[model samples]
Target: MFKEQVLGLMDQAELQIEGKRKEIDRIVDRNQWKVIRAFQKHKVSDYHFAGSTGYGYNDRGREVLDLVYADIFGAETALVRPHFVSGTHTIGTALFGVLRPGDELLMITGRPYDTLHKVIGKPGDGLGSLQDFGIRYGEVALLDDGSPDYESIARCISSSTRVIGIQRSRGYSWRPSFTVAQIAEMVRFVKEIKPDVIVFVDNCYGEFTELTEPTEAGVDLMAGSLIKNPGGGLAATGGYIVGKAKYVELASYRLTAPGIGGEVGAMLGTTRSIYQGLFLAPHLVGQAVKGSVFAASVFERLGFVTHPRWDDPRTDLIQAIRFSGPEHLIAFVQGIQQAAAVDSHVVPEPWDMPGYEHPVIMAAGTFIQGGSLELSADAPIREPYIAYMQGGLTYSHCKMGVLTAIQNMIDRGLLHLEDN
Candidate 1:
């Protein structure tokens, strides 16, 4: 029944999509911009994080980052940063960028990313959560299936609330997130409560979820790693935050060393790579989604408690498989790596590392687990559920890697082979 509904929606949506597509039919007249062709040709640069390259300080690198930022977010922004470690660090900067001590913040969702629990004082990690800064933090629960609980969320907001934080994308979690309209609704709710409350979105896996961005609806600030979305899947490293000019100005100061102008003076890159990534993205993303559906369908048949979201996708890409134990976790990752490695076998073991204390074991088949189209898998050391993440810069690469991973397990009698 759900499949039928989805098919119906897609059928109807296609007509409208075509109408919209026709409006931009001239964006690729060959004479328009060379990027259109370059992207189609899959000539995007290899996404190498700046940190891997010893972090170049070239001034033009920053300019290239800014141009890419403007193109992706549709807002003239100063999206810049160098040392932003992971998603949580970027979120911390955005929260600090807008809400200071003595201010109140509504976490728009009740349970934010588990990593942020300490940052907002939920688990009593004194220095990490919101309590450390003297800022009052409020939580609103996600509905049973993980959509926004709008009314409860609205009640949490007060005049003391300076900003509302929204995680608009799916990271390594199974939560179904907010829709574009839902994000806009949160904006409307905050505006109704207090005209000045700003909305901040952790926009990973969401930049291309819709054709436009959160800014188009009413969001004030958005942040995500450069590698995940805007770096066109080729960025070596870094993250970005774009929105209202003033908020970006504040976040920029907190994000970069003094005098580095937003992304303007921080990022150096291949104009060809960023351009190509975005150009081929619409099609490449669609292909990636196709791969996810295939994974979900195949796994569900094997009876291993699959979560491919074949019928309903909460967000972009990143399919997950649930194994029951840590040993299984290691096995799952190892299987995927062996199946997809371009070279030697990549082994995964559960280990606890710095910053995040919970033991996280991972197999990084790509450059980084930030969706490098290279095969990779990671799981919490305690739980056997490993998230199999990969995206080929092109469809063929993604297809081969996924099938090989699945096949490796099946041949070993690990996964039921004929599931799909």
Candidate 2:
């Protein structure tokens, strides 16, 4: 049984977040209908879920799936494939597909997720990154409030700038994620300055949270992982790129070959999961968002700092909770792991995770490995220790995870719950 204090905290949190939960449900309704309409428009059927063999040419399911995604995201076309190893690989493919040796890539958002640092690469690092290919890179850091630095962005644009990138989610950072409206404004601002520059958004962890998407907000191209919001915890593995047909085509070329773009890759047997995952995405996303709200409210009551406070507008699923130090951070993460339905016995430890600069600890007791659409929490082992908790297939599971985390902290004498 959960401690009386912990259960009392959750009970109060739920009462406090009731209105926010209603707002989430409203968004879910619109997004669910949007998805259903897309599937219906494409005449999705069991036949479309069937798998294909080698050279998977003219796979009807694959073709139709692309159409559904494009329609839902309001893009000219889309490329959704299981072949995409991760979100990083998907974004990289899109970048390399359109950027050339003389072209320059500009990031309007502050430093992107840790993984992309290597992809951007150091000049002459010999790692074959964008800089290594002689493609220039520059960035306009976000302002103190985590808003785009418009002045810096305007000054940074130049004739060589080709792709202007935005990260919709705040990866491992204590910043608010960009809303679709904010992104649309950014697109308009950039277009006003350089009408030809392509606007790209790394849309990981931000899909389906709102009624509309970045592609609909005028992004030239966008990418995300299937094991994230779009996957609905069902897609074994994959990623998606949606936007203008031309940009998507170029990305497809990078995904496959110059001539065999989006045409030859086989789905193996992931077609059904991918299709169903998209269909269920909006609802599952609502569940995750609700969990995030509860986590924020619960922790906020405990006097811990929570980004996008319980009532703040959410543009992504991540809920960042700031702890006093490493001990509190570790206990919180371990509590999340202990609450997991899978691998609950495993105690996570910080280690040098690939594609990251710092040692990271992750509580990923999920059915599909690394599936953040399920309940998970992770943090970098560094100062100002903060844990980023995201995803839950169901709100109950997410609540349990949060409560368990608090209880774990209390058990260790790292946290104390007094009468509030």
* Whole-model Cα lDDT of every candidate shown, in order: 0.59, 0.95
* Candidate 1 wrong stretches, greater than 4 Å: 1-68, 81-83, 121-130, 257-283, 324-329, 342-344, 368-374, 381-390, 418-420
Q: What is the total number of backbone clashes in candidate 2?
A: 0
Give the alpha carbon lDDT tens digit for every residue of 1-420 in model 1: 123332333344334334333322332232123334423343333342232233444545344545555544666564655456666778788787777778987876665665776677743456755667688888776777767887787677776889888887544556655667878888887788788888888777665545557877888888876566445555556667788888887887767644653534423434445444555555545455555555565455445565545555435556777766655556656666665545336465666665444677665666545454334555665543656554545545544554555555555666553342
Best by TM-score: 2
**90-206: candidate 2 lDDT, tens digit per residue:** 999999999999899999998989999999998899999999999999999999999999999999999999999999998988899999999999999999999999999999999
Question: RMSD, model 2, all Cα superposed?
Answer: 0.8
**What lDDT is reached at residue 406 by model 1?**
54
Give per-model TM-scores: 0.76, 0.99
Worst 10 residues of 1 by lDDT: 23-32
Question: Once model 1 is optimally superposed onto the true structure by TM-score, how far is the C-alpha of residue 274 displaced, in angstroms?
Answer: 4.7
Alpha-carbon shift of residue 47 in model 1 (angstroms): 20
